[model samples]
Target: MVANPARRAAVTDAALELLGREGARAVTHRAVDAEARVPTGTCANYFRSRSDLLAGIAQRIFVLLAPNPDRLDELAELPVDDAGPAYAGYALERLLAHPNLARALVELRLEAPRSPEVAQPLTEFLRAGFDMDVEFHAARGLPGGREHVLRLHHLVNGIVLDALTIPLAPDIDPVTQAKDTARALGR
Candidate 1:
């Protein structure tokens, strides 16, 4: 059995890489085992079923994609009206830079509705992200409150989705889109 947390993370990382590089169908336990360079049956030992593996992958996605704590702290201390655009544009730029992460997340989200195992992980990820947004806005006494945070969450998801799948016109800038969305949040 896979007893080490590092080994489990490695297996999940391999599964995430497979999901990004191939698709959901390519992330079987044996494939992850081979990709992770662990012993055969290692992934199976760690994850009892396909759904468990998928859930593990979902968890890994958040670990890889979540913002840096330092950056979050800095943003939390800044005036929202003055710093909101900067934060939004920075976030969009980071998202644009990590297309693979976005693809893996989008893939998991697509799979979540049909797979009960993924649903909890996906919901947890969203909740955590939403909570962070709420804290960030509340820390700065920003208006628009929880509803605005939810709207921004949906907007970010849509922008990330477009960044992953749809090719855009040269002039359709993600940074601009983010800034516009932030502005709509009523400062």
Candidate 2:
């Protein structure tokens, strides 16, 4: 079957919505087709199996959440002392902007352990993003090294997960929490 970029994107997006709203159990080819408002079998045409569909949602989440290059360039121009928190704030803002996307990602992460096919691509994509962040931090002479970057990733993951689900400190804004966490870790 000829691949339609728009249709594929729509299918993935619909899958994401399902994953976000109803968890992974609700995401199937037929459900995705209904959610995306596409013809039956359209999701299967784009994603051949359940694993393929889940993996596609994982990819689509990152693509949707990726930082803006122009903004990254702006953050890169900040002083080393200021850059980390600035980037953290920007990243949190982006994640907050798409709560469903973040939730979808959380869903995928949860599913990864049960399915090797899901785990492989998710791990690869996540590691690739982490490596890119480490490279960018090093190349820009940001305040942290690989370990610091790794720490920030762990911290941010917790922060985002908490903010999305049960907030430990609901009164404290997530963005503020992210910036503070980044600043402390950057040192």
Candidate 3:
């Protein structure tokens, strides 16, 4: 496989855009090449198959969504009671800021169950992230433990899904809701 980091990122980013805008079916190698403005077979060079392409996108989504370490340090300094909501709000804000990445993640999640190739890597990456969240929560002495973090994950996923699709509470601010929900869960 090629080792051009910039080109690889471009290919995966193009795939993400296609997944976000046109759904998973539109994310072919040729289509990605066109979207990335690269020559033909460029995406295929980075990802040999459709499963590879989807898995690569899944990896890229997490990379793009990862919280800033510096910000995490700042949040860690907050009072224990306040930190949870602050972190939750910050996370939601970051996720909402990249609408395309969020949509692509949703599409990849939907595809995971049916495609083992996508499911394996996606599940691994998700589990790793969940574990890190649990560790962070524990280290920060946040309001709850692993279960609380899991609940927060469910809440955030619901909120993001609603935001992306038919919003149930369109009038309510998602970031506020996230912070409030985190506070409630902590209690």
Candidate 4:
């Protein structure tokens, strides 16, 4: 049978949108079929299982996170000043584009290993972050040792998740903090 790339793309996009809007729990082969306006059997035929679909989506997300060989270009060098902060803006943009996806990723990470199916993207994403943090540290002449930089990266990740979990501040602008952090880390 000939594969229709457009049909597959539509199903994938529809699944992503459903996952984004309703969280992972809402995604099902049937729901995806309905959302895509495709045959229910078609969803199963293409993806085989929900886990497969999730893994495919997760891989897509990782690609988006890094976005090619120039993923570093997403952010300016370590010392992105108040004038031009590419990474800060990019981070915020990513979060805004699909905060729900971020939340789903965090939630699913715990159980990802249970299924070898979903494990690949989860591991890839985790490993990629570690590599990025290392490069992020090295880019600044190792101002802080590996451990210190790793600690900072963890802190940033935690804070981003916390900010999403509970909105304690009604008007907290992350940009200012990002600038302050850049200055502090640059030193």
Candidate 5:
């Protein structure tokens, strides 16, 4: 079918917003069309099935979250000792900027195993971070490279989730914690 890129993006965005605000069940073609203020059948035309719609959301999530390639290259070129803190700062800034997108990601992950469309994006989304971490550490000659990156990933995920969803412990500072974790890993 002939496609209008802008329309497709709008539909995809509407689907994502629905997924973010109301969860997976709210992402039907009709709902997306309504949410996007498009004519009836618009989303259906763009997305042949629920799976297609989900895939679009997944792709959009990846695009929204993926770091800039130029920046990554620059980071790679930086002195090993300095790259880690820059990477950490970049991550924390993105997380803070898009809480809703992050929450939507958590929601999509919960649905990924049961939904085929979600599986690819979920895997790619996750692997992108893992691979980036490994590459950064490898470039910097950081010890425990992949393992340390993985640990930092888990740590940041937990801290972000907690800070976003629940009140933190009295002394727990998520930003400071993230910076500290990144500093430790970088060293």
Candidate 6:
């Protein structure tokens, strides 16, 4: 049978917290085990390799992104001035929910230079996210097709990247920032 889901979840949450708080270099198995309050070797027992742990963390992050289907749908429904701001707002909320997962996401991109297996999933995730945004934008009155979609996609990606990595005032509102950014971009 698979490992205990609760224990696994606890460990995953701890890992993400560590990732967000400590950066990628700090996500050690021992640290995760300690953070999860699991005994030594517990993390290793569940995730035998660093890559496996990272992949599992990714899975957990996707789950964390949407704990409830209704909430996920609601996330998709939040009105924005344009597609770029929508992406930014979503990205901000998702990132803020678990800073560690956000940090891991950025770290994963950096790791692309070292390995393809890790990069592949990140690439697919990005593409799928952009595709969803395309549909959302089209639904909201954007007339252009693929080319226009790419333009908005890239713009949002830049916003998300900056928002995640760049330090901002604690009170910065993602929706407001995204709206301003989109407007500045002439969206």
Error of 2 at 112 (Å): 0.8
Best by lDDT: 3
Which prediction has more favorable lDDT, 4 or 6? 6
Local accuracy by lDDT, each model: 0.81, 0.87, 0.91, 0.63, 0.78, 0.67
TM-score ranking, best first: 3, 2, 1, 5, 6, 4
The residue pairs found clashing in candidate 5 are none
TM-score of each: 0.88, 0.95, 0.96, 0.72, 0.82, 0.73
Task: Tell me the deviation in Å of residue 187 in model 3.
Answer: 1.0
On TM-score, the stronger of 2 and 5 is 2
Q: For candidate 5, lDDT tens digit of each residue in 2-109? A: 479989988888888788778877778899999999999999998899998887788888778877778777877766666666666667667756777777777888
Residue-level lDDT of model 2, residues 10-104, one tens digit each, is 88998998888888889989999999999999998888999998988787788888899999988888888888888878877887788878888
Which ranges of candidate 1 are over 4 A from the true structure?
none
> Per-residue alpha-carbon lDDT of model 4 for 1-187, expressed as tens digits?
2388778777777777777667778889899899899976777777877888877766666544553335555343344343123354345446545676666566557548676777877788778777876676467454555665555555456546766677556377654454456446545
Of 1 and 3, the candidate ranking higher by lDDT: 3
Q: Candidate 2's C-alpha lDDT?
A: 0.87
Count backbone overlaps in model 4.
0
Best by TM-score: 3
Choose 3 or 5, whichever is better by TM-score. Answer: 3
lDDT, residue 54, model 4: 79
TM-score of 5: 0.82
Evaluated at residue 173, the lDDT of candidate 2 is 94
Q: What is the C-alpha lDDT profile of model 6 across 60-135, one tens digit per residue?
A: 7666765345654664565444544555456566565665576676776776557666566667776776687677
Which regions of candidate 2 are displaced past 4 Å?
none
| Residue-by-residue lDDT tens digits, candidate 3, 68-184 | 999989988999998998988888888888888888888999999999989998999999999999998898888678999999889888888888788888999999999998898
* Poorest stretch of ten by lDDT in candidate 3: 136-145
State the lDDT of candidate 1 residue by residue for 28-105, as single tens digits: 989999999988999999899999999988988888877787886776776667576657666777777777667778
Local distance difference test, candidate 4: 0.63
Number of backbone clashes in candidate 1: 0
